[model samples]
Target chain A: MSRRILNLILGCASVCVGLTPMRAQEFKLFERTVQVHGFASQGFIYTNDNNWLTMNTSQGSAAFTDFGLNMSTQITDKFRIGAQGYDRDLGQLGQYHPSLDWAVADYRFKSWFGIRGGKVKTTLGLFTDTQDLDFLHQFALLPQSVYPTDLRDATLAHVGGDIYGNILLQHHLGDLAYTVYAGHRSDSKYSGYSYFLTKYGVTSSSFAGLQYGSDLRWSTPLKGLLIGASRMNEEITDNGNLSLGPGIDFTSYSAVSRADWTNQFYGEYVIRKLQVDSEYRRYLHDQIVSPDSLETISDVRGWYISGCYRITKRLALGSYYSRYSITSVAGGAAAPFFPDQTDTSLPANHVYDKVISGRVDLNKFWSAKVEGHFMNGYGNSSFPDGFYPLANPGGFKPNTNALVLKTSVNF
Target chain B: MKNLRLLPLVAFLVLLAPVRARAAQVKIIANPSVSTDAISGRELKSVFLEEKNSLSDGSHVEPVLLKSGPVHESFLRQYLSRTDDDLRNYYRVLVFTGRGSMPKELGSDAEVVAYVAGRKGAIGYVSAEAGVDGVKTLAITDGRSPVERRVITRIEPEYPETLKRLNIGGIVRLQVTIAPKGNVENVQLLGGNPILGESAVAAVKQWVYATAPSRTRIEVSVPFNPQP
Candidate 1:
């Protein structure tokens, strides 16, 4: 089935290329062209907990891997299309799961304006939400906070449609470029054996959600340095049902500020929040527990600061520090079942993480990178409970560290 | 025995007298229409090097040269302090970069004289004995204080009796100072083909004195024909 799909994609690409008009005086059918390009990276990961390393459980380590492919073609003088897919393997048991990362067709009205339809990635906050994985300004491993575990895998990619454009402002003060966008998307979820048997008494349930987000970025020159600030908001509606009610409806707001000096030194700071109401519920066995109903309001807040230095034309070094904290206020009938049961008030949990990375450009079309991460305080909170149950207990140490190496090629 | 000795002595004196009395000959010429009193070697160098394209009378002057051979080599060494090989290589780079073109090269001294004399903007050099009616001689300078000497080699190749020509060989060194008006003011032998050095130097000095000074380097070359 996968081979068939790959063949179909290749066939479509060839047809697109064949349809292009050839240049004047040229015998070739197509002078203009389309291309498919992507990259894959795999590495070994060692964690503190042996149970977390599902592959070779006795070995006390895990292998991390990911790969993605993007196909882009110019359909006409004013129209273009692109589709992408990405897969990641947490461990052997988790296997390889692929997601339709993006599928969009864009019509450019002019040099500065455009409109797009189909499944599009939302331009929310900063970083890779709108751009592809390969175009990230930082390392492959993002600041853990802004890209939280739940949001990273839980949020849907390639939303329905979007309208986006940029405005250029050039002045004596400096030059400023602003990008704005609006879009909607659907979300999907996977269930574990225990959750599936105890909760809905089903193996899995696929749900679609409404996603809307907008981002505004402003850039200006101050003291001979270029500085910018951006703010974005996204809300997801839970249309699927749990025992207590519908799945948790949530809203996220993120803000980012950046300063660049002479294109040599750059620093950025970002803050994001994922908030859900108290009516949310999770079904376990014959009982239904309203995790949100017990709380007046609950939200997760995360932020990070990162800086990068260009060591040479093809090499760069960067480092970032990020922190995430979850806060909840308990109330109503379901308060006792929630974690931190001693207090009707929930104790805030925080995770502190730092990452240092280096990148080397092997050529115009190839690059390699290595990064190390140091995390402390709330290692138990990093992964989703349904994915890794052993790491949820409070007995485990809050600290964990890991290293990753990756390489990519594009043409 | 005494009479035989006198005949031998007189014959020896006759042969030695002309050898000792031979003075270096140099040629200098300008277009007949050019009313300027004379041209200095410095002014000539500036024009040939394209540093100054205008003459004293405000007429545009383009310098020409012989493409190759002993004359081309001798002339370039005497005035430009460069060899024909160096000039050709330099032009190759300049042309490739679209900076400039090489100077036009004529076939021989007669052709050079005829071309320069017939064209208003053209300037060229030839043997001292080749000087003709259409061209006039210009002054030259050795670039010494107090104007120590006036040495000019006239190329009257058609009238060999008018000038005694000698060939000196070695590298010729000439220092040229350009004036504010973009013309050559001073020409001095910096060092060269040692065999053609003296005649080359004298001719260059006289040429410097005859030309108007400008704020540009003007270095000219006048090669003496091989001694006949």
Candidate 2:
């Protein structure tokens, strides 16, 4: 057909060929000064009653996939340039659309001061930095109540500059890491903001927004103990004729903690491992509505506690309980479609999920995981009717069971 | 009669162990750019883990690695306390998170040595017998500052639950050098089960030692034998 179509076909064929054995070897360039790496993953989802990430996954659907390629060059002792291109298909979320995940030019001026400018991965939770790398953890999916995948686009990266540094303290106090960034949030269609609007049937959506925040983490001298707090504020210009009127202000604050403990048995590479991770977030958004001329703030809060123990180096077992609540309805514009209603058939904004998972790391670059989740709420999703199959005979069931299995390979 | 029959086999294994251990011989080497002549166990871990990127003298340091070999395995077990696979995952986290990049991983000791010798601030480990005419061999010193090596605040290692449940017991030996300022400066894993040794090292490194006029080194033995 056309040249574009031909190129697309060839690219697809090349990726397909590379993925059959789906492994990336270390590719070096310029006398090994530059390094390139990549990964691809596919996931299968099954639910008994409701859909977790996509529709019609109850009977099993392979609608989830993530492919990424990244490269970095250490130009000097204190400078480096890196970038990654990623395509994710989670039902209609990414639809295999390619996007720049992150690109940064870094400068480490001193031990206590450094700067990174460009698209930077930005997340405040304990494991949010590794949120996209499924092969690193014991679960196929992170606890969504706190680190929702749907909201990743708008919150996962910042297109501005960030200043970061560390200060080492004495004794048990440990070291402190602080990162502060300022820039406009990503307004891509896959953004959580876009997800919120589209899922709520809000037309004429414009997510152009300005955001800034800082995160401080304290790595205690107590080995694997770490605690941190993060906060970000965003101002969105709706430019919409429907739903959120015009101006929306969102502020998010989170407290995070994590610890890794290895068993003394087996020693070395085969140690039995026990790890605990946690995060709690409070969200406040200023929404405005006309006609009634009502202005109010909605408060949403969520938290999760997770523990994983490695039975062996390659195998790990884990479980977690997560809950999210619309703590306050108050006066804010809870929007029109998914309005603030304490008594409704759809409850609309509360979610609870309990998950148990197991992961088998086949090797350094390959892994497989199986996770089962008992979910009672859909607060994590921005949809009003929810992501479950509408064919439900019971007409809107809040509780459901979902099973997820995934195989991931990263170089 | 059965035990007597296997005596030669046991002796054979005992005598052959040294050969295998020798095959895994390792030494720490650094580029000529690195000015430090010594590194403690703690400092080495921090550098390789991407936690600390510079030496005590503010000299920038980059960690190189041999992809796979007996020397590579032994080096990781001795210093990083990780398996080769674990080390790979660790680098993945760093690169994926945009925190750091994967170090220059060479295929063999010669490759690593050549790379290290040619680059500034490069550090790598290789077989002890590997020819290293260009690179410098840095002595791993336990006594960094003699006056700061005295332990004033001691922390105990928490026995791992899996080990406690299985009733696994051992003593993890560590060589620690106290900083002149009295902070736990460097700790090197000398002997112990790898897993238990990791926990013991983590705990001992957090200890606050008494400061003297100069730094000092001390040997520590942490035992993990949970009581009923």
Candidate 3:
């Protein structure tokens, strides 16, 4: 009769309801092929110490659920259109907010050229756009250093356009794929950044920005070897209010990003049933916070190398070593409040996680995953890598261990 | 002693014969509506991969697949160079990404022949021993590496004046379908700036390729680098 149990039942029921219509992989509509697909996943998380991503994981919680439904149709030989709707409740993040993940009208004129415009997925690195299609990957969770779940909404898609195509290089050099895009980014109110800012007495009202990026990848002639690079530029502004002193003093505040950009490099190799992937990313944020007249600079560097092997048709084993660190932080007037912001050597400035995972495909459409994490640091509070100061008010331990069990069903 | 050694060699040859026969057991069968009597290895791969939809003779083609069988395994290994599971995963990706749809899958060689026989452009593969009475068997020629086709001519895409003035330059992708005679038959823009893609398509349409055994589809990239 507890509220937690009630919520769990309701969540499961909702996912079941969404999956009822996906029995037929696809159906005909007006003599055209209209495909319907959906996926739902529920996860249980438990941590030996410290809460993760706003979840009360110390006592174990099952407040992790996400689902998406999509339908696509090829209207013509060269024109296709599709849309996906997504919703998730991850601890205190996402908060069960439904979102239009992507709705694109894509037109392909040739194998080397195509254009899509609408709420389109953004292509950054190898997995940014495809992150929502979890079943395609072996690990329960992608490396937090590169593909953080907490920041999913921020980089998932954009309301703009993309031009993408694949090219076959001459002389057996290999194949190259390229995408260039420009779009507007609008973040949700229940996103991780919003919650993280609340702890600093900054309640963000709106977070909007303009983003443009280009991604180029080479599918080398060496069978399954792929290498790519991406560059993204963003201009964001967070409008909020700053809290002063103790009792009820608040002032209008704004975080104006002067320069924000990310550069990423990644490579993947697949030989037989074993696949290996690695990526390195550098993100720089320079902002001016008004009302307090503070200027802060944060330089984030993260990288991970992971490998997954399909031991059998139904089972897969994967492991990853991910490292995330705030290489530099310059908190002008806010240094006194957060001392670790200036001390780069402190454990609070970085997060190094080692994870091992196993997945079993119960059937063609259902899978279950068990993952264990051994983390060495909590990372900087200013940048949320699943750690929130408000969740761990008792302070964080130097090292923490956690277990995650997740099940996914898709059609 | 000599007879005993000969027995061992005979036994090895007997075991190897079946594998060799299985390698060539699959046959490509097409509906009578198809214009071409023969298909190259590269063209067969292109059709199955959903890259090229029409043959050089201007007949639209549709690929048919078997759910799973020895014939399916042999066709995947010899022409596609992919395992059954790999091909399935590839089709899944294509479907999920909205690039292509899954082909019609039949359970047995008889069902495949019946389906292809009834359809206009349907093509399928079956065991060589299967009675392909209604459908015609297309001989496979130039069974070279499926990825060996090369462009014999190149054309540079012109940068858009406005975009060039704005210093907006990037690579444009186009899918080019070439006829067996080596001339570009059709060009479609795959991805790039709209203006740049138009220019790329225009220029690529004039490019030619080395003579191929059959119609082939190849992706090409055109770069528009603006002056700094």
Candidate 4:
């Protein structure tokens, strides 16, 4: 990756020329306060041909990275609590381990009621609970047709409980924010769908699921608009094995999925230093597979539209136009046990792309970005949306053009 | 075409030079135990957007900030419409969503009139040539014009049969607060499609307005038309 992007641009120019001036950190403990936050990022992908997500980015992958850390406290004035942990690798997906990513405990009790419980974080649309708060975004990637990032742990947090609130619409007509959750996700056999199911020789081991959801939003009185919607439901299962060829035998396979669901719909609009966003999602699933149950049903669909401006105060600019698709509808009893659920008549069943980004900042908690993609389709490879077929074992290509370089930091 | 008639005098001298360099003389001090000397620009944008901590003569308030000058950019663009990186990303999304904290900025207007004159339910702003002697300068009143509460009655909302059978319509904002003796004492939902914002907050909680002089937060919209 160009010598890992020149050693991450000389380690972000010697930490932006030996930086100084930072914030976000607090402490007090029993006297309340607590705080503390953290973030880190790095990326450098290049492509001219194929090899994307499973990263080799056509021989130029800087094995993206990630980092996080959090802490919080309120301890009264309506109780509070928090936690975070996170880590990433991205090339073959989160192989660096370190999970946790949320801990919750919240309480609230007014501003229209509240409640929360462990693991939380899963609002679903509009950057799904601030997708790892990447310095609150300007995009380095977010709209791989709706925040994909290799299905960031299949919907990031959820180990149970939430109730949320924020109502206040009387005569001014503006304010409403709900939540309602349920949980128990689990994934991560080294994610990215267990490394794209080892290109069909399967081998997952377990996956787990049974989510639930709701989200609502609406902070509209026209000033800096916002709108939201989400709805989810899952059941999942996975298990693993299947191989039996040129190997010491294997074969157990499983799939399950008791009628999945998803819906999403978003919008945002800001009017100073410009900003705009849009989203749409769908998802339907319905699995059954196994030694012979069959049944399938897929549907997926994604959408996007983006914009960013902040022209100055350390530059900013963005663009987007993503799209994704997946069909299948039980391809004749699951097309002989899934071939990435093909049939959308080629172009590997859809993906569109068309990015363009730029960000700078370099202080106030650093930032740096440069994106450009053009992509066109390579979708259906077991939907992580970023094409994979075992990271392209040299077999499909319709269009590709990429170049990314990221850098981040948070305080 | 004669430079399109000097394009309307060069767009009115480029929007009158940023509205005369962002006019905003500032001054709205408070803290003499804040029992009012007059306030209201929507309660100083709900006490600097901590969304109300009191005032309307019930006193209690705190708000203080300045950390950036030009009267903290004209009191965050004339009463918190915000900007200063949108009020520091709205207080970093209220301190990363734990909802609120980080207010009390300070750094001149004589350190915000010496921390809103020794804090006591604070409140601040200065620069109409600073020197506010021991606080309490208030007096504003730009109620952001909504032509004094009209609509004395209006209801309308009821479209949700599975979102009008899935064709889903739009326009559902609501933010009513009225009650100075004109009903609608609350009704949030300020955008659309939360099942048409719970049917526009149940028909704007039984509409009725015009009786002002105090409570009044108006903003309504509710149009759901799945064609014919």
Local accuracy of candidate 2 as per-residue lDDT tens digits, B1-228: 876876675565445333333446567889988987667766677678776678878899989988788888888877877878678888887788677898877898889889999988989998765778799876565433412234578888877775575455555657877766788788887655566778888998889866667766765656666553
Q: What's the true lDDT of residue A398 in model 1?
A: 49
- lDDT against the true structure, each candidate: 0.45, 0.68, 0.79, 0.74
Decide which is better by TM-score, 2 or 3.
Answer: 3
Give the alpha carbon lDDT tens digit for every residue of A34-122 in model 3.
88877778788999999997899999988888888788887775687888788888888887789888888988666567888999888
Native contacts kept, each candidate: 0.00, 0.38, 0.10, 0.03
For all the predictions, what are the DockQ values?
0.01, 0.31, 0.13, 0.03
| Top-lDDT candidate index | 3
Candidates sorted on TM-score, descending = 3, 2, 1, 4
| True lDDT of residue A210, candidate 1 | 41
Over A1-411, each residue of candidate 4 has an lDDT whose tens digit, in order, gives 454564466456535632766677788877776878666777778999988887888878877777776788766545668776887777878756788777788776554667888887788887776675666788888887667788777786788988877665665667778888998988888887777877877888888888988989898888889898998898989989988578568979998887888898898998988888998998887887777567677787889889999888998999989888787644345466555465654577788888989899876777778999897878764455777887787777888999988877766
lDDT by residue (tens digit), candidate 1, A115-192: 777766654344435223432344756665555423343333445655544443433232333444445544434322
Evaluation by lDDT, superior candidate among 1 and 3: 3
Tens-digit lDDT track of model 2 for A136-222: 777888877666776665467878889998776644366788888887665567544455454333543455566678888876756
Q: Model 3 residue A141 lDDT? A: 77
Higher-TM-score candidate of 1 and 2: 2
- Categorize the docking of model 1: incorrect
Q: Place model 4 in a CAPRI quality band.
A: incorrect
Query: Model 4 residue B214 lDDT?
Result: 77
